[model samples]
Target: MGQLMGFLNIERKNQKERSPLERVNDWNEYKEAMTEEGARKQAARCMDCGTPYCQVGVTLNRGTSGCPIHNLIPEWNDLVYRGLWKEAYERLAKTNNFPEFTSKACPAPCEGSCTAGFVSDPVSIKSIERAIIDRAFDEGWVVPKPPLRRTGKKVAVIGSGPAGLACADQLNKIGHQVTVFERSDRPGGLLMYGIPSMKIEKDVVDRRIRLLEEEGVTFKTGVDVGKDITAAELKKSFDAVVLCTGAVKHRELPIEGRDLQGIAPAMDYLTASNRHLLYNEPLESDLDACGKRVIVIGGGDTGEDCVATAIRQGCKSVVQFGKHGRLPDRRTEGNPWPEHPNVFSVDYAYEEAEELFGKDPREYYVETDKFTGDENGHVTGLTTGSFKKIEDGRAEQKKWDADLVLIAIGFRGAEDRLFGDFDIEKDPSGRVILADERSYQTSREGIFAAGDARRGATLIVWAIEEGRKAAASVDLYLDGKHSLLKS
Candidate 1:
């Protein structure tokens, strides 16, 4: 470690955030960068544990424990502490192809497992990571470095989300020709659309896309792979195909008046907001929450984001419903240290809601029974319920007023249409292009699956990890040699 006693000497410092009152007025990134000295001090707090559990990516109890990408957390922290900014960026980029996205959006699992977090706060790992990458860009240290030679093998990667981008970047680095296909006008799948602009700016995604293009990864936008192009065509045109399409099928809340005009899916709402913010065009539909009493069903990051977005859009009022009971602030006995704790958190959105509404908007242990609508077929209110767990069962019944209902209950699986058209075999979950953990190969020969399409909807870091692993498998399938993408 740089100072050895740095953890004792220095205090943890995180990125400054915009004031809730002011930041909620518009859509923009909330967190401000910490000063260089502050970032260094935070980096110095890394104790450099003997094992470094923060980088030990694995599954515990069927969930990701540490960083799925197995990022070299302590290594980069040491590099930052030593003022080796470029080297820190190199080590950071070696594992994560897109730190900008994860630094901004990921729920930091590494921090949860941090050795320092057991005694005090974690070493501000996420903030230090953001600083390292931003400094790298400012110093002009990041540049396009195409592979020296071409392998003459071409690969078509479906979907331009995090997983697909990471896969393309890795394959391109190893001298394989990579082309990413996106159905939307933009290249970044969820990063470009599903997420609100307030969290992650679209320019950041565009900048990375530009870098990938410079690095010889081609991007084809507005091209539906299974529709405009066929699976058989891709198989014939390219040596291998990798499905990186994310789990985007929004879960529906089917109840009375569910077909009301004013009710919409959370993705549809967020996507419209993003498109309007990014492209200055009107939303495809009039789905704004403005002036309406917005009721966001399901309490997750997505629902919280809806609260934030609705506030910014000047909604009359906003409320979030959670079927689960409120969690404790600290980890319980079942979830001990080194495991990502299932604890209650007040995210930026919640803070903004509290500041604006004079109270937290979340209502826990509640479920929607039915949607109440006016004669014009527009959502007017909602029938709600409180749940109580009985012996081997659960029970509920209640009601409330909700003019605009946004269901944010998360996704079920990837759209089967894309896979069905290709005749790709799927799991019982109806997820695209089945494959094994080790090989990541699909039922169809020379085809592979990774990320959300292979697994399920997960974090950005997991998607990146899957992309790297799948690229290795694809490389091995194409040529008898192993891929250098392995961490």
Candidate 2:
């Protein structure tokens, strides 16, 4: 609203990314930051629309329409446009615990639901958000602000992913002594390992982890809760326990030859690569794609990450298979405005694959039949059948050569065995049975579950929202009265 018809006067420009050919050679972040002026101009494009849908934060027709955490989009856009970088960051931090992570990795349902997008391009909300947070860090505005005093109550948060971290951060801010436990070597469960460095550099994840440590959140790495520490011991040690353990039980292709030597779960592949990159672990000792023909089964962010990781590892060739047909170039009639678009566009990994291999690596509408292995017990290739529709007759099966097959199909629920020691009820799908939707408390008293553990697999933003709500619920349960902590 700073400029009259700012939406009409300005054009949307995204941040520049490193050239695919060059970026594929290293594990550095791909996207570059936008100039301050460019970001301000982009913020000005947030038109003065009544009922800003960009922050509606609702789900319509099974698709998210806006920001899941309900960021104050217009307020910050105006602040950025007026060159109030600090104010913008303040407004952003009010709701989002980690703007840097979201701005870099979130799919940006906010932009998809922007009122401006009804006619013209949506405002560059993600870029402006990134600019504000990155500037805040550069100016040293983001620092540890521990609570004025301790509340004497202690909370134990299991897992160190976004949901767990957010839950721990909120509780710590409210004066509760919070301790986070991660089963992995690093504290950041998903951010540090699941996501490739090209999307979010390791330094960014480490910076936040260090800040949390400085703010009085204790992190215990390489500590498996069920095995290393018993449920009875944890209950006796902490006043309350919050399970933020994510849904990491990967779904497997139960078809024949699934046990082949070269086949591995997508998360294992990504985790191995990231560990090798950060900890200098021998890639060959785990799952290395070097000089191998890689095939990624299933599609989505995980599959894209596999493709990008393989490219970085100097794979001979890579291909991704999706059982569904290609999405339309434009939104279909059913997917209207305010809904996250279901249209097709090239993602970074696809673009990089095309640049290096001279062709897109996506093979849609293909269903894998079975794996074919050589006598040495190593995977050689796989057979896939093409389908025009879900019920249609499949075309003749075709064989594709692949030395390594990464299954990115998706996750089920949390690893049930981890919670077996505790007498907590879970749904048939393995999700913890919450006492109620209003309270994230699990079946047992003083125990709560959030994020993927309660909701199954979901976006990081939703996980953050779940964590905040769980924190508020926990605070109420602990105080036995109205809690000041915001959900």
Candidate 3:
């Protein structure tokens, strides 16, 4: 480390964010860049523990703790502390294919497991990572590096989300001819549309896509695999096929009056908002949240995004409902250090809503009972109830106004249409194209799966790891030897 006792000398510092009042009025990112000196100081706070649990990506007792991709955290932190920007970036890129995206959107499990966080604040790892990548981009060090030799093996990756893109990038780097198929108009799947523009700007995604294209990866956008091109054709044409479609089917609240108008899914709403931002097009009929009293039914990231978007679209008002009670401000008993603490958090969207609405928009311990509709069958309001889990594991509901209801209760699994079309065997969870950890090969010979479609809706870091592992498996399957793809 550059400063052996820097942690004792300096307090932790992070990037300043735009004030709630100022940032809510625009769609730009709320976080302001920290100066290079400030970033170095923050990096110096890394205690660099003996075990370094932050980089030990593993789950114990069904609880996940550290970075899923197992990033070289302390190495890069030391490099950053030493003002070795390029070296820091190199160490970061060694494991993470898209540090910029993960830095912006990941929940920062690494920080949660940081040794410094056992007593005091954790090092600002995400902010330092973002700074390193942004500096790399600014210095023109981030550029296309095509493989020196071509393996002449073709690989088809379905879905261009983080997992699929990471798989394609890894395979292409190893000199395999890789092509990515995306159903949307753009290359990035969830990163392009499901996420709001304010959190991670679309330009960041586009910039990386451009670089991948320059590196000779082919992208076929607006092409549905099963519909436009059959799975049989893909299997026959490409040396291998990797499914990374992601878990996208939104779980619905199937209570009475669910058929009423003005009730939509969270992905639909986010997709429409992003489309409007990207293409200047009118909002889709089933997706707009404008000029209505909106009630978001879930307190996760998607629900927070709904609150922010409704406020931006001039909704009459917005509120979020969570079935679980509000989490404690700090870690609780049995939730010790190095585990991802289930502590309360105020995200950027919540801050925006608080500034605009004069209060936090979240209502915890609440569950939707039913929806109320107007004469024209439009959603007028909703009936909700306070839920409490009893000793016997039953929910006791106690009945609250919902005019527009959004079911952001998360996804169950990936859509089954493509899996069925390909005759791919699924796991008990109905996830597509099952494969063992060792082989990453499907029930069928050359087919494979990775990312959410293979696992479930997980962190981007996990997706990248799966992609790299799947690439190695595919390489070994093709050439009878495994390459340096992190498997």
Candidate 4:
């Protein structure tokens, strides 16, 4: 530890943000980064706990309890506290291929597992991480480091989301000729389109993509691997193919008026708005939530993002309904510290809504029975029934009032076309079935599936870990039994 008893002396002060009212006017990231001294002080709050649970990366109670990538949390914290920004950045980059993405988007299970949180506030791990990486970039330390020699083996990575990008980055670093295929007009499958710019700016994604390109990773955008170029042709051309297409088949809300004009999947609505903000494209007529009474179903991160998006788009009102009743504000008897704390806190969108609308826009234990529409068949309102939470934790019914509805319950699985085209078998959930748990190989040889495509939808850190492990597996598969790749 950089300073003994620093945790007792210092307090946790995170990166500041622009006020909710001031930030909603534009689509830029509202975070105001701290100075070096401020970040160092925050880093000093890391307690020197032997066997620190923050970096254990264990699955406790069906969720990750710590950093999934097993990042050297203490090492970087110590380095940052010592004012060694370069050393901190190096330690962070060693485990995380994309700290910029994870630091911004990850829910930070590491904080949940922090020992400090048992008594008082947890260490500001996420803020310190962002500070380290942002400093590295500003100091021109983050540069393109292409491999010295090529392995003479070519690999094709399908999709340009975090998983695909991490896989491509790793394979390229290890001397493989990697070409990433993206179906969208721009690269970054989810980072560019699925997520809003306010959470993570477009330029941040573009800068990382540029670095990947400069490091000899080829990117082919606007090329659908399974559609334009058949999977058979791709298999013949590349030595190996890794599928990180992501779990994107949004779960549909089936009921009466399911086909209403004003109801759309959360991803489709987000993508349309993202494109409009990024490329000056016209937003789809049905996708816009401007001046509409928006209703978002599901209380996950996607639903929260949609709430923020609709608010930014000038929605008349917004309400988010969660099937499960509200979680306890503090940990319950079954949920304790050092495990992934399942406590509830008001998230960003809800806070912003509170600031704007005088109260949190949330409903608990509610179910939307059906959508109601006018003669034109457009969604005007929804019927819901409210139920009291009991032993079974089921929803009965609730009331609803909405003009635009976003079904953000969750994703079912990956798109079936790519896997089907490649003759890869899918599990019952529609995810590409892996050959073995250790290796990310699919049902077919010379092919692999990682991230959400192999496992169900997971965290970005887990996705990166999968991509890294899958890259090692692909390297071994190409180089034979005695392959020296890191597995």
Best by TM-score: 2
Put down candidate 2 lDDT per residue, 435-481, tens digits, no spaces: 45778888889989888888888788888888888888888888776
- The window of 10 residues in a row where model 3 has the poorest summed lDDT is 391-400
Worst 10 residues of 1 by lDDT: 388-397
- The digit string of per-residue lDDT tens for model 3 on 172-239 reads 99899999999888998889998887788999999999999999999999899999999999988999
Kindly report which residue stretches of model 4 are placed more than 4 angstroms away from their true locations once superposed: 387-399, 428-432, 481-487
Q: Name the TM-score of candidate 3.
A: 0.96
What lDDT score goes with residue 296 in model 2?
98
Candidate 1 per-residue lDDT, tens place, 139-251, comes to: 99989999999999999999999999999999999999999999999999889898887888999999999999999999999999888999889989999999998998889
Candidate 1 collision pairs: 381-402, 384-398, 384-399, 385-398
Residue pairs with colliding backbones in model 2 are none
RMSD of candidates 1 onward, in order = 1.7, 1.4, 1.9, 1.9
TM-score of 4: 0.96
TM-score quality measure for candidate 1: 0.97
Best by lDDT: 2
Q: Candidate 4, residue 16: CA error in Å?
A: 1.3
